[model samples]
Target chain A: AQTIHQWPVAEIKAVGSPLSLGCTIKGKSSPNLYWYWQATGGTLQQLFYSITVGQVESVVQLNLSASRPKDDQFILSTEKLLLSHSGFYLCAWSLDRNYAEQFFGPGTRLTVL
Target chain B: SQWGEENLQALSIQEGEDVTMNCSYKTYTTVVHWYRQDSGRGPALIILIRSNEREKRSGRLRATLDTSSQSSSLSITAAQCEDTAVYFCATGYGNEKITFGAGTKLTIKP
Candidate 1:
């Protein structure tokens, strides 16, 4: 069984503050990892994706970045947060090379005040 | 931007009733996926309908794809309270990555 874990289910961060959200996967090795952002009342936006360590593809740049330090560890971070940066962040993994079916994490809710 | 900008906005239905949501894509895709997102949660894969198949079923849900029209439809029968969620349609043209639509908010008036 594969499972996804995300840290800090909810957070309140001040604008211009640094942010880091972590995601870890279990029961899988070398899977495709993705980070998506779903703004309030908006659609899910793919921010970044990585097929291997030390390499990530930016789908839609929004001043945030992601890194896959290890096979099961992925981190989403930003040097400074913006008010518009606040939203629900999700981490997903897929065994399918084309990502037909992606398993998602619980997600982290961030509120920038 | 890859999906319909002002299409398939939302849908409303009653319990025990049937409803279908449609999606149209701009690019050629070999696979189409449907995801359900509950409030304050991440989206989950509900079904993956491929281009080679016309329809697929899971429990009480059924999905139909029309490649010629570049569209798809998801149908839910005997819907329950748990069915009230946002439904998103995503496409995988030929690569591992996918692009998602704005999603249709399905409100089941129970």
Candidate 2:
């Protein structure tokens, strides 16, 4: 069994402030990691994906960047936050990329004022 | 429909009734995944149907995929109050990125 953990269950920050969120997966090695953002009642938008350590790919330009510092860890950060950045951030892991089903973490709730 | 340039939809039904959610995509896809999200939680994979499979069933949930029509549908039987959540259909066009639908909010009244 694999478990995914996300830090800072919730955060309230001012616009233009710096922000960082972290996720760690246990019991799975070389898993594909992904970051997603969703508005309160809107669709989920993929932000970034990581296939290996030290390598990350951006799916959309939401002014956000992601880094895979370790095989089991992924970080999502931005230099300056925007009001539109307020939403629920989710971390997901999968065994494969193309057709694998992803397991998501508890998620982090961000409020940019 | 919940996918391709459409807004989110809401459906309310009484408990023990059956409900179906639909999604239509514009691009070509090899797989269609169905997910459900509770309030303030991440989406969980409920069912997945491949182009070759056409249709798949698990317990009380049934998923159908029509590659020719570029659409998919998920049906739940004997809906319970705990089934209230948002359902989304996602497609993978044989790529790393998976496109998700706008989602449908289902409310099961007990």
Candidate 3:
């Protein structure tokens, strides 16, 4: 069975601080990875997606960037965190992008102080 | 822009009652996915209905997709307290990306 793991289960950061979140997938090869952000009671927003290593596409611009450095690793980073950046960050993977069901990780809860 | 938006913002029902949540999309899509998100957790896929299929059932949950109307609906029969959560409808336009709805908060009273 495939499993997805996200690092730093929760984080509390101040505005203007650097932030980095990581996600790793096991038991699956060459899967599509996606980054999603959701506010406390808002809709889920797609931030970035990567089809292969070193190639990431931006779905929404929120001053965040993602990189798939390895086949099973994806990282989301920002130099300066903003108050609006606080939310739940989710990592998902799918076998294919076309109508395929995505599996989500446990996710990371971020709070900007 | 948000692709899929649920008609009802929230719902409250008693246990064993049947509830239905509706979603309407703006663009054409080949598939519609239903997901349930518990508090402080990631959303999980509960059902997926394709354009060619009108209705699909999984245990006590039923999902219906109407291509002509550009809408979808998820129905839960004999709801339980555990069914209390936020339900979202997601639509995929080809291979571009899957967009999610705002979700409907369902509270089941025991």
Q: What share of the true interface contacts does each candidate keep?
A: 0.66, 0.66, 0.64
What does candidate 2's lDDT look like per residue over A33-112, in tens digits? Answer: 99999999998888888889999989889999999999999999999999999999999999965868989999999999
User: What tens-digit string does per-residue lDDT give for candidate 1 at B1-110?
Assistant: 66777544778888899989888898888888999998888899999999999999999999999999999999999988889999999986545567888889999888
Report RMSD (Å) for each prediction in the order shown.
Answer: 1.4, 1.5, 1.4
User: What TM-score does the predicted chain A of each candidate obtain versus native chain A?
Assistant: 0.97, 0.97, 0.98
The TM-score ranking, best first, is 2, 3, 1
Better of 1 and 2 by DockQ: 2
Per-residue lDDT of model 1, residues A15-99, tens digit only: 9999999999999999999999988878888888898988888887799989999999999999999999999999999983775
Model 3, residue B21: what's the lDDT?
Answer: 93
TM-score of 1: 0.95
The models' CA-based lDDT, in order, is 0.89, 0.92, 0.92
lDDT (C-alpha) at residue B20 in model 2:
95
Comparing 2 with 3 on TM-score, the higher-scoring candidate is: 2
Best by the DockQ measure: 2
Question: Clash totals for all models, in order?
Answer: 1, 0, 0
* Residue runs of model 3 more than 4 Å from their true location after superposition: B2-8
